[model samples]
Target: MGYDEVARSVTERGELVLRRRTGTDGPAVLELRANGVFVMDTAEHSSEQALADAALASVEQPRRVLVGGLGLGFTLDRVLGDWRVEHCDVVEIEPALVEWMRDGTVPHGRQLLADRRARVIVADVATAVAEAGPASYDVVLLDVDNGPGQLVHDANAALYDVPFLHVVRRTLAPGGALVVWSAGPAPQLLADLEASFGHAEEQTHEVRLQERDEHYWLYVARPAAGRPEASAAG
Candidate 1:
């Protein structure tokens, strides 16, 4: 396989790198890396799509969906695939990342940005969760960082905490599901999810990428019945 430089930019979060890679066999692929960290590429993203599919599966006729971290628009695209999804609200922290999509830096970028149901917001996802009204959404999908153990940004760790999990629970509609994507297994995150929502489950996606098998984890949780009443006493 051969790699070529496409473009690079400096953003508020960190250095953003874009590249086009070509192999002896197969199509040229686009890559996005942030601060020397490998984010993802056009080559494969089954796990990302799984994040949406797994979350949406748990909800019935989900009309409003909240998506955190717009990585190459895979998760958002998957959410929009469902006819039942009426609106998809996406929160991305980096303006450059969104611009990369809007300006055609990525191949499938424009398609997602142009989707009528997609509402892209260039701001911290955590802030959006905190500001969301109670029972505002049917599903919340988050793929912010690598995982709690290996965060691309230190501030992202806050999203996995119990307090933020409570906020996520509070923002969801009754029986709403919150799905989080992690690079690998995160037992602590699972415990936090269960502690906040009172019920949680995980799904693992195993994929072969870059000639190696990788396992990713998705934690899905829903607030227990009468959770608000239970919280009132605590």
Candidate 2:
């Protein structure tokens, strides 16, 4: 067996990491904390596809959508593949990840980054939602971090909270949907969604990769047409 060149380093939080890039066909793999965490090679992207597919199922005639993370451009690519999606705004905090997509480090990055219908914003997903105009988007999909429970960054915790959920609800058009991708089950997050939205549901799926089998969750929430009945801190 053989492997490509590997670049190893530690993040600010002291998480040991590795990046492996094989031949032209291989996608870069990012390993966190020496646990072989989150392999994002180009072979398969069932989870990303699932995020887009699940969100699209609940939305009707969705024109504009906001994607919280741009990992491997798979979720964005899947959303752009839909003809119903006229415009997409992708927010990613890591400039390097955005540049990777632009420089072809990831396959299909160039095409998706340059598409007129898509706009990539390099900023925090929470701030982006807060600043968005009321009822501006038809769908909001969040795939940042592992999930509400296993957040990669501390700031992301607030995103799943009630106040942020309020902002997200305000940013969506009537009958619009908010979808979040989680590495594991988040019962508290689910309860928060129930308090803010008209209808909320959780979906679980299995992710099969070369090294291991992983289970993930997608929490779908929809805003009510009227105002929120109560306010709860996340």
Candidate 3:
């Protein structure tokens, strides 16, 4: 009934650990780790849900969507609730995380994973996004790291860079949407998105997990339809 006696399990990675702490608040909460780094918990997934909701709202008729992270499958579950989303491809770098979901370590994960409309890809988000054909997805919701400024992995830093932003833009259909979930406000990343897509907006939401007004920023970028025409005088 207390956090001290919580059950713990060490996955094959050996770097990450999962803990389940029972309390009177609700169901048992799950916690994640990576080489002593605290990843996420199940107490509150507001940002994750918001990431999916914001992306779904921007699309006119989104049939296919790409979710860059599988944290607790909250985002995936929210996305699947939308009947308009016919196909959802989730890209998760950690195989253990995927296995945990399939094995029911994370509640509701098995349901979403078992859904015929869902496809779980065990690969880096960047690679998965690159392999996807241009204009292939109506929306892309990314939550791979804490944020651009506080990345879990160094390689993920490029995800917020210009080159990767272009890849995301190309992968989205005309007028398609891209939504990224950050642990906190990322002004530089928002600026990068604006410069790449010519249209971008940020939405801040409160996450009660930390209980200190945790901020999560959602970056929504809409791809342009056509290239600008050259000036006749030029």
Computed on alpha carbons, the lDDT of every model, listed in order, comes to 0.86, 0.79, 0.82
Candidate 2 per-residue lDDT over residues 26-110, each given as its tens digit: 4445322223455355655798899999998889978999999887788999999999999999998767667767977555689
| Worst 10-residue lDDT window, candidate 1 | 225-234
lDDT score, candidate 1: 0.86
Backbone collisions counted per model:
0, 0, 0
Q: Itemize residue pairs with steric clashes in candidate 3.
A: none
* Top TM-score model: 1
Q: Which stretches of candidate 3 lie over 4 Å from their true place?
A: 1-14, 228-234
Where does candidate 2 stray beyond 4 Å? 1-18, 21-39, 225-234
Tell me how many residue pairs clash in candidate 1: 0
Residues 64-99, model 1: lDDT tens digits: 999999988898999999999999999998887788
Ranking by lDDT: 1, 3, 2
TM-score of each: 0.95, 0.85, 0.89
Evaluation by TM-score, superior candidate among 1 and 3: 1
